[model samples]
Target: MATVVPEESTASTEVKAHEVRPPRKPSASQIAAARSLPNNNEAVWPAFTTKLPSSLYIDEDRFDEEHRKLFMTLPLPLAPSALLAEPGSFVCRDGFGQSVILTRDKDGKVHALVNSCRHRGSRVTENDEPAKGRLMICPYHAWSYDLSGKLMAVPRREVFGELDKSELGMVKLPCVEKGGIIWVKMDHEANDDFSHVSDELVADFDALGVADMHMFALRKHEVEGNWKLILDTFLEGYHVIRLHVQTVGPLYEDTVVQVDRLGSHLRQTSARVGFTKDILAQNEESVDDLRRVVTYVYTLLPNVAFICSQDYCNMLVMQPKGVGKTIVHNFMLTNVNPQSEKLRQKWEKSLELTDGLAFPEDFSASAATYQGLTTGVVKELMIGGMEVAMEHYHEMIEEMVARA
Candidate 1:
């Protein structure tokens, strides 16, 4: 018989820093959640049902308000640092409804520029793919800017006599690189203070080794649903045993999740079928892989979802195209580059399991749910006990929207 430990017994014990920890170990919150894992016969559930208005998902006016208040004001994690691994590399992205260029200067500093030329207002580089170069020259008139967005050269410099180069630089957005992710605020006038990104969230990501990972694969999907709906699919495990039954269902325990709030953000940990308390009792210095026994999902509120698997991590960036449209960018990251053909094939297989099988199931469900909400018959969506994290998520969004 499996012995069930009381939640207090595990929750009260502090995990010391001096103890030898496992590689790519759990964050402090994750450690606590792991310690409180319920036995096979025991179950955990939310205490109340959260009522969310259908307008939150289908009303265009409400969507516009959210876009203005939350999306425009908050700092969003836009891209993986591995996307700009080499100095002088850059990628043009328009997922946020604005054409922006992310570049790493020769000195290895990252910058987010408006992507338009200072002179003619044309995009400096149109290529969406990652490329390496020192200067971004506008094809319109050959005006050029360096990787740092400094207007370096003008073909007809003599034509514009007394023009100040310093005042002609491209519009630069505030950017910060932390936890191997590039966070950018869309409002150029907003202060550079990123205090909204809490220390606990960064420490959790650092523990997951996101900074040193390799960008294995990236895929973008356009879904006919609100961006929040797409994000809701990742916040709970309630549907895994139902919606994903044919694919990833059997691997996860239904309604067996541990959720902790990291400020406004959330961290959800779930044990696999074979998980045992003994897994957590192993010597911290031992080479045991925690990912084998548990899975971690980090929701960096309002936009990103980071899911950790045994081998690779999936980082999903949900960009709202409209009230009922979204562009979901999925990035698969691994600890090491897949140099060998065999290794590349191995990761490819994992991608197919997610991007191919499991993800489509969630996307389809979100799209269908949005379609139903648009009919105006359903006034309120009930968030049940199994989806408590999602309830907290919506509450945070409501608070931010109201305050902003």
Candidate 2:
């Protein structure tokens, strides 16, 4: 059954609502820090190269611009129902900070809704609670909306005054699910259609040969850097030899990275290290179990990274927390092994191992880069040849922000 994600369950609605709060007046020290922050206008564009500036890692203004231009305007893709694997399944994503309700309804539709109620604006759903049937009742004002977001009933509309149910339905974002991914435009005009964003997505994810996988394990953490910084960490494998020497460097070819672009979409590929001999000696029959494989890394428009491997896959989603903070979600998956408990355990173990290995390295690099970039030591950034993919990503962002 295809899962329909209701509008409020979308990540964009969740994150934006979460981002909406009374702005905090900066304290004296904070203001001082901001004023003292480096502004190397001359260094903003370095000589022709492939390496981006370390300053970009922590620029306050640039970070703010990204929030307004990228997240607020661009649409991000979500995991599809095929990825959810079953009815009654749901994942409570911390959309930056907003609570987003993602569930497979009884009719097999996926619903992404803001957890807030339409009446008093209180959070209506918790992270894991599932609402069944054709309607969802707000826990706060008892206002109820149907699966399609129509205001079905309110407790005292007739007694107090006839409320306009037609205008009180939950807000819905533009969303479409395919290829085991759900995609939504965050702040598009009401009539904007997002289904045409990707030619490949239009063809369907299953048709792309990457469906039927179930999440084996999911891990998330808070990083003290902009979401772009966290995303950039995964954009190129150039740092593998240096930052991830103890982990990924041992299994990935850090020197060679390839890239492709589709409008705002981007893709990269890196040769998975550690098993060249195995692949050379193995026949087609043994391809599925080989440890080292060519990994396909892709970013769909805004901020999603996916690494599809032979037997399993991994996704790293970057959600912004604020100007200089981000929340990272790492989901590792594999085809559901219906008959073997050992295989399932292996999948779980692989996820734990990968997460434990990669996160510490990424965090340390991102934090250092963030702090270092805050210093006004440089003018322009350099994006060297090795990190061309990352450079392309920044170029796309710059173009979008400039237009916005």
Please report how far candidate 2 places residue 316 from its true position, in Å: 1.2
Top of the candidates by TM-score: 1
Instruction: List, residue by residue over 1-404, the lDDT tens digit for candidate 1.
Output: 00000111212334334322336655666677677777544665657777889998999899889888887898888988988889999899886668889999998999999988988899888877789987889999999999899989998799999999999999999999988889998888888988778888888778777877889888999999998988998887778878877886765565467878787688887776656677656622211266656677888878888888765788989999999999999888876775556556666777888888888888999999999998999999998887877877888888989898
What ranges in model 2 sit over 4 Å off?
Answer: 1-48, 51-55, 80-84, 87-92, 96-99, 128-135, 201-204, 274-292, 337-339, 378-381
**RMSD of candidates 1 onward, in order:** 6.6, 14.4
List the global CA lDDT of all models.
0.79, 0.56
| Deviation in Å, model 1, residue 36 alpha carbon | 2.1
Where does the lowest 10-residue lDDT sum fall in candidate 1? 1-10
Candidate 2 Cα deviation (angstroms), residue 344: 1.8
lDDT per residue for candidate 2 within 13-84, as digits (tens), equals 223332222222322221222222122221122235655665455666766677776665665665544445
Worst 10 residues of 2 by lDDT: 1-10
Clash count, candidate 1: 0
